[model samples]
Target chain A: MKFLCLECNTAMEFKETATPDQGSLTAIFECPDCFAEFAMHMNPWETQMLKSLDVQLGGKSEAAQPMQMVRSFLNQQNPDNLTAEAPTVSTEGGGKCPFTSVVAEAFQEPVEATGPVWTPEALARLERVPSFVRSMAKTGIEEFARENGHTEITAEVMDTARGNFGM
Target chain B: MKTYKDLPADGGSNIIGQVTQQVNRLQQRLASVRHIVAIMSGKGGVGKSSVTANLASALGLRGHSVGVIDADINGPSIAKMMGVRGQRIDYGDDGVKPALSPLGVKVMSMDLFLKDDETPVLWEAQTQKDAFTWRGTMEMSALREFLSDTEWGSLDYLLIDLPPGTDRLPNLVDLLPNLGGTVVVTIPSGVSQLVVKKSLTMAKKLLNAPVIGVVENMAAYVCADCGKTEDLFPSGHTEEMARQFDVSLLGKIPFDPRISIASDEGSVFVDQHRDTPAGRTLIALAEKIEAFFNHEV
Candidate 1:
């Protein structure tokens, strides 16, 4: 398809269109006169517009399939933010209800993540996660103690056991 | 938090900058002094200061326009030894002028700043501060404002009588970058000989100043009654050492009982005993020193 070159303001032909996995769309258009490759916009709105146009040009409708549920499950399981409202279904006990599963999943905090950052949000979440986990874990243990009718149980007992057992 | 730019539009406010400027000043000019000889020894009891006083006197007597700067900041013995104690520096528009010794050399010392002659330097780390004061005054931008600063004018030689050691005030000698050289003094004794070696090595390493020669003071005691010479230590250790170092042998000063008495009487040895052996040796050494200055080695 023909298009107006953004840089040289001349007529140009579309060279290629590449769709990125991370919701970005890029279109390479070559100017005939200046022989320059003019890059289109890079924001989300531009990407959405390019995708819609691709569908109108007899291109297959690239349905925005929501990310795989398991992929998101892995992401929500990120140790970065314990409060990120992740979906939960207890794998060990399918008998547990959704709320109970969420509580269990949220309480089962991962060990401190020391791996290289794979995303910006992951880094930001990492900074805030440790303290959040500590408080949530404290609340969870206290709730477990009360539920089991062991209301008098204290952190000292937990600490002693952890220390003796090499927890 | 005032920056260098916000300094009070005056030179005195920025002391560090002023001192740095002064150090650079000496670094450029230390080697330019016609004759810069630092007199020092490692041990203090060896009468290094008295020897410095008299040697400077002897040099002045030979008609050289000499200036003796007492680097012994804490224990400035030059004023008393040179018999210029309690003398106030003459001040006018120029700066503080160094007091003239009886024998013609211009003499300066920190002692002159004391309120009285009997005042002992009681400051702990007094030596360090004195050296600092000397370096500051000698190099600072404010030097032009003081009269004492003006006294160190052009001269044939500037003899610095340093505090007896390679440590403490010896670093002050490094301040005079153009220092002509050094003269190591030692009394005739095994301990003094070993200590004087340290001083010589320090002069070579720390000051990088040349050791023109070594002078053994009180090498032999000559009895006035019998006219027989007693070997106080080994008679010619200084000579042997000088030969080893390949420096000029600047003769020895015998343990003339008269030298002590003359010093006590506020008199220099060469002045009292111009015909005596000790005086003649000093004269000969002075000749050799003059020869060194003249490049007639």
Candidate 2:
């Protein structure tokens, strides 16, 4: 897709650079016609969207994703929230789940599917998969099981899903 | 129940739009600075920050507009060495104005935020005893803030003094995409070269950028009284490291006792001791860098 410069309405060259603060990467649109450079914060949604389409944005491994930058960029604008949250630094005031903003496009906790709960054994089996691909495998198994009207994923259900689906 | 330790230093609940706006502001702030070149050494205690501070001064001596971003978020020594150790930044209507060094080079570092030289960078709220516990992601965000918030009016070269690691700050690759290249620093020792090689690998493999060359710091000790030079480490060893890495051996920065003393005194060695042998070599090293910048082999 051609990215146009919003200010000049001209054909813009897409450029990206890290913000000076090193908080997050910014996608810059440089307009040759008007010499205008526009940069926007690179957000998690874009990364998630790219992942869903089987695209790797910037070749970073999933093991250590760009969640920090996504979170940092958001927090920088709201510095007041920082002091307020400072008192919440204790273990009791636990923050968001680390894995929620990672792994795949959905970036959400696995749902129960209203059919069957994945036993601890099954979850352990899935966890054994390499981190980069384990999430992919889980999404595959869950989808296959849910579509076929299976409530819980047992060893037998896993075998059927494995035969029918691959991450 | 979860705590801050379980998540990132700061959490992103529902502020994607606001974050994007800050990013735009950061880009605009750094638009004037050009050709960001990072200096890194894989291993710590290799004098990378000292080399960076002096190199910025050396470049300024050559009449080029230069600015340095101390990318060593946890261990910020660039500001201290460059004569702005305890200086705080000025934030006005436009943005943060980087501290001016004695030799007119712009410097931005985590040190600028500290109230005093002894102040601990308690970036982590529930601080840990070990310095290594400073999260890389947290440092990366702080770095992002330094870059975005600092207003450096157009510069010829922006040298980034990267922290001592190839993998430690992986986010640096994304932060400064158009790095002119990297200048790897090392001391002439088997141990130093072993780690320096990894630093070279970081640029050639990880960052996929060019290795401009290597500056062998503490390569020799020059006697101030008699002008006698003692090559502490064999010259052939450092040369071989450069040859094996396929990068130019830029210069051997002599270990002038005054260099460290000057750094401790909040001075750029090259600027304070310009008449010394090491200082002259640093200037020549700056010329070599200039030649590389011009794409002249």
Candidate 3:
């Protein structure tokens, strides 16, 4: 039977087309797109052939333990494409569009709105300004907020706008 | 033929989105310009366009990269004054290519769109009595479209020749992000200065634009034969405005009849006569402008 390539989900041919050996729990599948080989558990093992292969392969005997041994092999090779049965790789910000990396690089730097957010009380005081100079007065207040490093517009900022900035 | 090519190519489905796109396009186009200045007068009969043409020519001749935008939507004369009148704007791989003048100043104007000298730009609104009543909103959009679409590659200076009054100032002023400043033009008469003061206050308080200085055009008459200066109009208001408004007093220009004559003849007086008193003053004005941008003054 054909199996799905873990990385690209493409149908890939198995190295051995016949029915899996009885009680041989693991089978090897190769992905054609990424050329990564992964071991998938096929059935339970009834014999100690795994132990014999482990001795021949000269590796840790733990790799021959059970159905979980083959899954660990799949985890190492296709780490990013895992599911629960088949889990998707989800990061902190969730899945990103494949096309957005270049655009994200451009917007990496953002202008910080460092000034204090305008207070309603101060905004009401600014309401006394003539319509003609309203924008100018608001800008002066914000500029004062930024230059003075205040996180919120207080009575002091309004006083400065009135006296120094000619509001 | 009607040429609306400067307009954004949308068929009017999304108005706000299209205008925002146009603004984004203009910001990208003009980002390379170092200084954005406009020559404005509070009233007409101030020879503002002539100053713009000659000043841009002087700057260009001084080896500075300068471009002139005749932002006078209704009465565009920079094309004629710069001797680039009747040159048609074309579309190449770039956007609307501004026509270059004989002095190498990239000039853009609505005059280039008219078929002939007699054709009037009547952007009419539907009225009960008048069929050809021009609309202010239409004028603003057209000016914005032209300003946004022109492919001015790069420059050290872009001097916009604004139409007189505060009405259309927003049309051009809204397009510039960092306007180096405006060179407010006015004659020396009290009436002219009084009107110009309105513009200064508006710029400082309303527009929040920096007013670099005031240029007193037609301030005096300098006799060519006797080297005597004559007071052509009341001569004290410019300095008074400068002192009261806290704006700099850039040099003054004498009322030279030849200045007007040369303008009408489509010749740049600053380039033709550098030794004449008026020419020297023009060159001096150009120097002061250079110093202002250079932060030397």
My TM-score estimates for the predictions, one after another, are: 0.54, 0.60, 0.59
* lDDT of each residue in B1-297, candidate 2, tens digit only: 333344331211223333343345455555677677888889788788888888899999989999999888667888878887655554433345688998899988767655344545543111133324334455666676567555678998889998887885357666665567888899988988888887787678767468889988998887778888888876677899888988999988889888889889887788878888889888988888888878887
* CA displacement after TM-score superposition, residue A161 of candidate 3 (Å): 68
Give every collision pair in model 1.
Answer: B30-B177, B30-B178, B31-B178, B36-B180, B95-B146, B95-B147, B95-B148, B96-B147, B96-B148
Chain B, candidate 2: TM-score? 0.87
> Residue B52 of candidate 1: its Cα lDDT?
79
On a 0 to 1 TM-score scale, where does candidate 2 land against the true structure? 0.60
Q: After superposing candidate 1, which stretches have Cα over 4 Å from the reference?
A: A1-167, B1-16, B24-33, B122-150, B168-170
* Tens-digit lDDT track of model 1 for A1-167: 33554565555655555533233445565766788876544454343332221121211111111111111112122222222222322122112111111111221222111122224342233325454243333344444444445423344534443364475
Task: Place model 1 in a CAPRI quality band.
Answer: incorrect
| lDDT score, candidate 2 | 0.62
DockQ agreement of candidate 1 with the native complex: 0.00
lDDT of 2 at B228: 89
